[model samples]
Target chain A: MPEISYRQAIKDALAEEIERDENVVVIGEEVAQYNGAYKVTEGLLERYGPKRIVDAPISEAGFIGMGIGASMLGVRPVMELMFWSFAYVAWDQIINNASSVRYMSGGLINVPIVIRGPANGGTNVGATHSHTPENLIANMPGLKVVCPATPYDAKGLMKSAIRDNDPVYVMESTLLYGTTGEVPEEEYVIPLGKADIKREGTDVTIVCHGPSVSVAMTAAQILKEEHDIDAEVLDLRSIRPLDEEAIITSVKKTNRAVLVEENRPFCGVDAQIAYTIQNKAFDYLDAPIQRVSTIDAPAIYSPAVEPEQLPKAANVVEKVLSIM
Target chain B: MVGFYREMVRIRRFEERSLRVYQQGKIGGFLHLYIGQESIAVACASLMGDHDHMITAYRNHGHALAVGMSMNECMAELLGKATGCSKGKGGSMHFFAPDKNYWGGHGIVGGQIPLGVGLAYGVKYKDQKGSAMAFMGDGAINQGAVHEAYNLAALWDLPAIFIIENNGYSMGTSQERSSSHPKEGLAARAEGYGMAWEIINGESLFAIRDGVGRAIKRAHEESKPTILEIHTYRYQGHSVADANAKKYRTKEEIDDYRKNHDPLNVYRLFLLDQKIMSEDEMKEIDGEAKQEAEVAAQFADESEFPTVESITEDVYWEADNPDKRTSEGRLFFND
Candidate 1:
């Protein structure tokens, strides 16, 4: 076992996959020469050469669709979107080509492409650049969505996404790149639709994913020390193949639930979780399910208000207390 | 020569039969007939070798037939039957036979362009001597995705052939009303991307062989990209639903194309004048083509619709193979 940064873990998974699969190639804007916008894909161009580490222009629709097309012919392309927000320009390709093509074509085709990049809004990057589209992308059925919060989960999930036989979208956070976590020095993978209980308790359940997972963990610690409320924190690593069983089981035991997410509240990923908890574990509930989410508006650009806009440990604790 | 004639006739006859079936309310959704633009697909498909790939827009029944897609599956697909190429999942606008290098029958106007470049990219990546012929209508040229594809193709020197089937009208808008008519024609826009460009009279199968043939060679031998603006015509409306086909233009113009630029009549006349086939033999071939279309129509007419149990089929690879499903969740959301 060893410690590694989340950014380095992603690089390791990519390198390992590239070494194993000849058909795997990295295609994106500045992924090669520029070493990625966040320096996540540094040294890959030199290691794998131009054929494997391809640099695409700032045309998300063009290169994304190109990766999908190549994937059909067995060229496993891991497409990098500089920011997942840019994916809106190529909505037709992602929705129609990448996601629905296989189903539409009656399984005559398969788009084994992985679209991965930063997808959080903590920085002061304004309204457009800051978008948490995990819910939006996961809303589509033919696609899979994964958001890795820790270095260990990041390595495990990135490898799984590349090898998965469907179109998998990996949403990472620029804020979590430098964060360190323990990762084993052996071949391992984290399966999709599985949740990890970061901390164990029985008073209340704090279910979250990606960036919100850390906030949940912090809120759990605070609830124990200040309010003396022992909260169980559940991290959903994969979004689409959502771990409903894990979420329900935790809620049943705790008898109370507080969902924390970085995205908006209107039809957010948490909305699905709330519905699931009420639908499945209605009798087990001790209180109505509560949610802590980013302020219901465009992401603020101010350094002061932006932090206020996103869900905080204080917000999660407040939600937990209200439910208690 | 006779083989080409048979394929062209088969496609034309198939389209006519499909159009009839469409009117009869047997086939659902949009049916884009490829009545006049037959020789272009016949010639283009004739040139495809071991590694060559082909993709086209929604009006793709012609290319599907030209690439050897059996009329049974294609017609069944149009009729929304289980035995269709896409198993009734994709109707007229999404026919596919990937094993034959026929990528698909895409619905979106310039959407297939980038995918075509990817096909060429895959070919070049594998060191295969192949090219991808991505076909689009005249209206698709204005789409932003097509230009992005053009830039990528030229920038990478991908073995891509962008075949713009300039059929004069995109849905209801005519070429004059919709596009900029440069001196060099619509495909002159390729010049902006520094890609090689050409124009061919799509009425003649011979002209397609010479023009599309050259572009394919450029892609295969030099791993370069080319844009061929093939001047073709469509006798049918955008879809069978486009009732304003005659209102957008005059009856005389449509009649003029039907009489003069009809690839079938022109190529048949050329074959007869060159002594490629006798008049009696040509008549017999037409009879056979019509019979084939009739059989396909009969099969599609009688075939069963997909089963209710198979409604969620083909959405994911894991759905079909539960044993190998890596993720643990409900792939299908049904009651």
Candidate 2:
């Protein structure tokens, strides 16, 4: 086993995949010379050279579409967006082209392209720079969306996304990039659309993913040590092709559920999870499904104003206690 | 030359028949006709090799036919029949024939430009001699994606040809109104990216074939990308639903172009004057085209829709893979 930061885990996956396959190339804005805007791709350029580690201009639509086009032939391109919010500029390429090509082509062509970038909001990057669009992207049928909350999941899922035949969108958190976790040194891949239970409990199930998983874990700890209430924490690593079985199974065991996420409450990922739990685990539930999510509004600019708009551990704890 | 004229005639007839079906309520969704813009697709597609790739925007019926997609499959797709080229999943705006290396008929205006560049990048990366051609309209020229794609294609020197089918109007807005410098047209924008560019008369099949042939050769031999502005026109309105085209342009202008500048008529006259084919031979080809279009319409009408069970299919490649889990049993209400 090896302890590495989440950022290092992702870098490790890129290096390993590039070594294993000649077709694997990383392309995006500042991914090569600048070593990535968030430094998640640090040291990759020197290891892989200019061909494999391509530095693209600040053109999300163009580079991302090129990645898709290249994938259609034989190359497996891992496209990095400086921020997931910038995907709006390339929405037609991502949503219309990358996501629909496989289905539209009758499976004759598969876009094995991985679009990975930071999609979390709590960094006070303002509305334009900060967006958790996993929910929006998950709405498309031809795409596989994954949001990894830990270093272990980051490495495993990145490897899987690169190898997968379909277009996969890896949503990372700017805040969790430096967090360390124990990951196996051996080659491994955490299957997409699977959930990982971070903490075990029986009283209530707090389901979360991405950066909000840590928030739910903190709430679980407080619930146990302070309130003497056992709260189980479930981390949904992949959003689309969602692990509904794991979600329903956990809710059925705990009999009470709280959905936590950093996205907007309206039509967010948590909203879909809550609906699934209520419909599947309705008979097992003892209380209504509660959710802890960002307030329905644009991301605020100031650090002080941002916290109030975002969901915290206290919100998860309050939701869990209210159900209990 | 007769073969080229026949191909153009085939595309024109197919499009006219498609319009008839669309008006008859048989073909559903949007239908973009290539009645007046057949020479560009016919000529450019004729220049493509077996390994080359082609992609274009929604005005794609002509490209599909020009790239050798069977009339029956194209018509079936427009009719939303499962026997279609895209298996009925993609209608008029999203036709695909990957077997022929035709990537797609993208609906988004400028969306296919970068994807085309990427296809060329793959060819270069694989050390293949093949190249890719991406077609857009005057409307898509202003899209930021097109500019980004141009810069990357030029910077990387990928083997790609970007053809701007300047059809006078983008949907309803005239190029003069949409473009910043209408007189210079989109060809001027290519100089900024340092890419070789030319504007050819899209009505003349020989001019189009020669210009695009040269660009494709440069792409294959020199690994260079070129921006080709082909000035063409669309006889019909933007889409099938744009019945009131007169609101934007005058009927007299439309009639003048239809009579004087139709690509099919221009090429037909060229071939006949050059003694490429006799009047009887030309009429025979025209009749065969009309008959083929009718047969395609019949095939589409006889085809069935995709079954309900397959609604979830093709969403992902691995339907039975153990790792792939969908939101199936988790929310099932009915036992």
Candidate 3:
């Protein structure tokens, strides 16, 4: 195992999938010669030819839909939506075709594709570039949504998504690209619909995913060190087929829960996690499920507002403290 | 090529029955019939093998049936029955039969263009030899997605047959009014993509069959994408429910097209001239089609409605937990 940044982990997973499966292809705006908008696809076009590492014109619906069709025909395409906010333009393709292809076709065709991109508010990207995919695609049954908090999870989960026989939405965070974690050097895949318990505790469960998972872990450390409160942390690697069992078991043990997400409070992933805790682990509840989330506002370019718009470790700790 | 006449008959009956169902309020949503465009789908589909796939816009009843979807499932879909191809969730505008390799009857204009390209890419990836026949209306050529898909298809040399059903109108706004250069709709744009192109009369079954055969073969064999502009017409308005416009064109224009260019009549006349079948046999085929349409309609009328549970089915491919987990574990605390 070796420590790598979340960005390097994604690049490694893509390179591995492309190397292992000739049928696997990557396409998106700025994904080719430029490596990627975020360099997630660095050194791919040179490794595979331009045909496999496609540089699609800026047409999300067009290229993304094309990826869906290619998947139907047997090509496993990994498409990039650039940013989660711009995914709206390709809703027709993702929602109507990509998500419904299997259902509409009576399960005859599998849209074994991955639409990956950076999501969540951060670093002065403004309203157009800042958004989360929790409510947007979580309800869509045919799509599998995953967001990896660390490099290890990013590589493993991405490999699994590319190999799975269904469409997957891989939400990356713009802010966490430099963050590093230990990753296995050998080929491996983390199954979807599974949760990783980052830390174990009996006082409270702080569940989060993607960039916010790191935030939750940091907050858990402070809770344990300063308050002597051991807070359990659950990383929901996949959002769609949410690992309810993992969250419920953690809540049952802790008796109190604090759901953490970087998305806005309204219709956010935290809301869903909190709801699940109450329903499945109601008897074990010691207090209401507290949520650590960004305020309901468009991400502002100002550093002042950006900090407020994103969930910080301080916020997570404070929310857990209030609930406790 | 396996079942040309049979497919033609099935589609004619399917479209006619669909019209009847629409009249009776059995079929809902936008219902674009492929009555006159049958030859285009049939001739082109006949040239394709199982390795090939097809994708099209909402005028897809003929394509679905031609590609091997059962007439009963199609009709049931039109009637919104539980047994419909889409499990009764999708109506006419959303008919999709992936098992048959028919991608969808996509409602969004030019939405399937990219998906079609992707399917062709997939075919090549599987080490299979074939092209995806992506059918779009003349109206769809103006859509930005069509241009994007075409450029990528040509650039990648993905096995794709970008077929434009140049029916001369975009839902009443004739190509003349809608497009700057109507005569060379998508074909003119093909040059920019650096791809070879062909134009054929959609009503001429021979031309359609030959042209599509060449396109599919060139794509599969040469791995080069080609654009075939099939000059066609839609007998009805955009959908079944639209009134045939009194001002769109002259009555004479409509009459001439009806008399001389009816694909079914043209094919029948050619068949008679060639002695492929007798006049009496043609009449019998027509009668059989009408009877078949009646039976399909009857089946659809008697089919059961999808249960409440069906709302959750088909959304995913999981063997168990068909209802797609409804309740999210969360609480709403109002301030």
All-Cα superposition RMSD per candidate: 1.0, 2.2, 3.7
Instruction: Give the CAPRI class of candidate 1.
Output: medium
Candidate that beats the other on DockQ, 1 or 2, i.e. the better one: 1
The candidate scoring highest on lDDT is 1
Off by over 4 Å in 1: none
DockQ of each: 0.80, 0.58, 0.39
Clash pairs (backbone) in predicted model 1: none
Isolated chain A: TM-score per model?
Answer: 0.99, 0.98, 0.97
Q: Rank all candidate structures by their DockQ, best first, as comma-separated numbers.
A: 1, 2, 3
lDDT of 3 by residue, A29-52 (tens): 999999999998888899888878
The fnat scores of all predictions, in order, read: 0.68, 0.64, 0.54
Question: What is the lDDT of every predicted structure here?
Answer: 0.92, 0.88, 0.82
Question: How would you encode candidate 1's per-residue C-alpha lDDT over A1-324 as one tens digit per residue?
Answer: 899999999999999999999999999999999999999999999898999999999888898888888998989999999999899998888878898789778998999999999999989999999998999988888899999999999999999999999999999999999999999999999998899999999999999999999999999999999999999999998898888889989998999999999989998999988988999999999999999999999988999789999999999998888878
TM-score of the A chain in model 2: 0.98
Order of candidate numbers by TM-score, starting with the best: 1, 2, 3
- CA lDDT of B110 in candidate 1? 94
Model 3 misplaced regions, further than 4 Å: A30-32, A46-52, B1-9, B97-100, B243-252, B319-335
What docking grade does candidate 2 earn?
medium
Model 3 reaches what TM-score against the true structure?
A: 0.91
